[model samples]
Target: MADATTIVPLNPDEEKFLRALGTVMALLPRVVDADMLEELPISSTEYTVLVHLSEVPHHQMRMSELANVCGLSLSGMTRVVNRLESQSLVTRQKCPEDGRAWLALLTNPGWKMLEQAWPTNLASVRRHIFSRLEGCDVAAAAEVLQRIAAP
Candidate 1:
């Protein structure tokens, strides 16, 4: 890694772009979280977890896998799972293939919750993002942002 002192400074346009990106990054989550919390019983993070599980084969995933994809620590994920469990939205079960491992399974109610929240989430995205961008603008933004977000 380069030392901070050796790092090159950004040009004015680059600095402005970086600032805009930073602001969006910081605020977008809050906006979505607020929208979800206002209209739904779940937070954005919980919706994210549900979405990932919904995409999986059995609406289930290992706790470690969920934690990784959600960018939460394992213990942090456990707490989130616990909250969902208490709400009857999810269930924790021992992994049949590995007794020591745990899986978070989305319940019927969890799927119902996702179904209920889908329209609000879509509308919020359209309002906050898609409606402001032309088709080509969205395509280009997706390409660049995907590259930046890749692990």
Candidate 2:
């Protein structure tokens, strides 16, 4: 039997794929940040927080839920949301079901900004990711990404 110290190695192609994936992922944030700065007032991370909130039903979600969706910690999300709320982009409402909990609500201004910014955001995404790949390859890439991100 093989010892725990022995492990199978990734083949050359597999290693290359991983290297490319890491590089692309590293650069992806810059792409988003540049585009967001040029087209919107918010940073890419903040835009993503807003985007995640926008996807929820009624354009509202709890702070914990938003943090999870945005891959952020609760405290980090709290800061972002507090900044956003101060900017009039979002509002915090006490959850009726749980007095201690709060829901982040997208304000009318936020909704309007999101609507105006969506097309530019989509364009940047398509330019950086989808446009470079073919149709079938794009679908395969999405599946591969999903598989990689899944637990």
Candidate 3:
């Protein structure tokens, strides 16, 4: 009987792509966590959640939608909202249109945080990732990733 665990070889392109992805993955967290956002008023998780809310209509998104946009689980988003609520960065409200749903509302403080974080964040991203790529290639890659992640 053939052993299912026998090695399955990756094609050259597959191996190359995985290596490229691995390199980026290894560098991303260290840069983002250490140099980019540590001094910011919000953690990356909080910032991403706020950014998602900031783009929503009236800066209010139902909790479930916020979770999907932020790549967070429902309970994770709830905890983030709880922390932001304590800091007055966000407000939690019951959805008027759906009594069972909760909405995440970006507050004035949250907007201010976003304002301060946005430029610096972009700079860090550029220095770490975008600046190294050819402009056209970077743009094309971004479009591809966006397409893959589209709802």
Q: Which candidate is the best by TM-score?
A: 1
lDDT of 2 by residue, 1-151 (tens): 8887897888999999999999997999898789978978876777787788788898889899899878889999999898888879999999899999989999888888788778888888889877878556767777988999887
lDDT (tens digit, per residue) of candidate 1 on 1-151: 9999999999999999999999988888888888998998898888889999999999899999999999899999998899889889999999999999999999999999999999888888788878878556777798999898898
Regions more than 4 Å wrong, model 2: 1-4
Give me the runs in candidate 3 sitting further than 4 Å from their true place.
1-9
Extract clashing residue pairs from model 2: none
Steric collisions counted per model: 0, 0, 0
Candidate that would win on lDDT:
1
Residues 1-151 of candidate 3 have per-residue lDDT tens digits of 6587986889999899889888886878678656545677566678778788888789999999888877889999999899889889999999999999999899999999888887767777778877778556777898977986788
Q: For each candidate, C-alpha RMSD in Å?
A: 1.7, 2.4, 3.5
What's the CA error at residue 101 for candidate 1, in Å?
Answer: 2.0
- TM-score of model number 3: 0.81
lDDT of 2 at 47: 79
C-alpha lDDT of candidate 1 relative to the true structure: 0.91
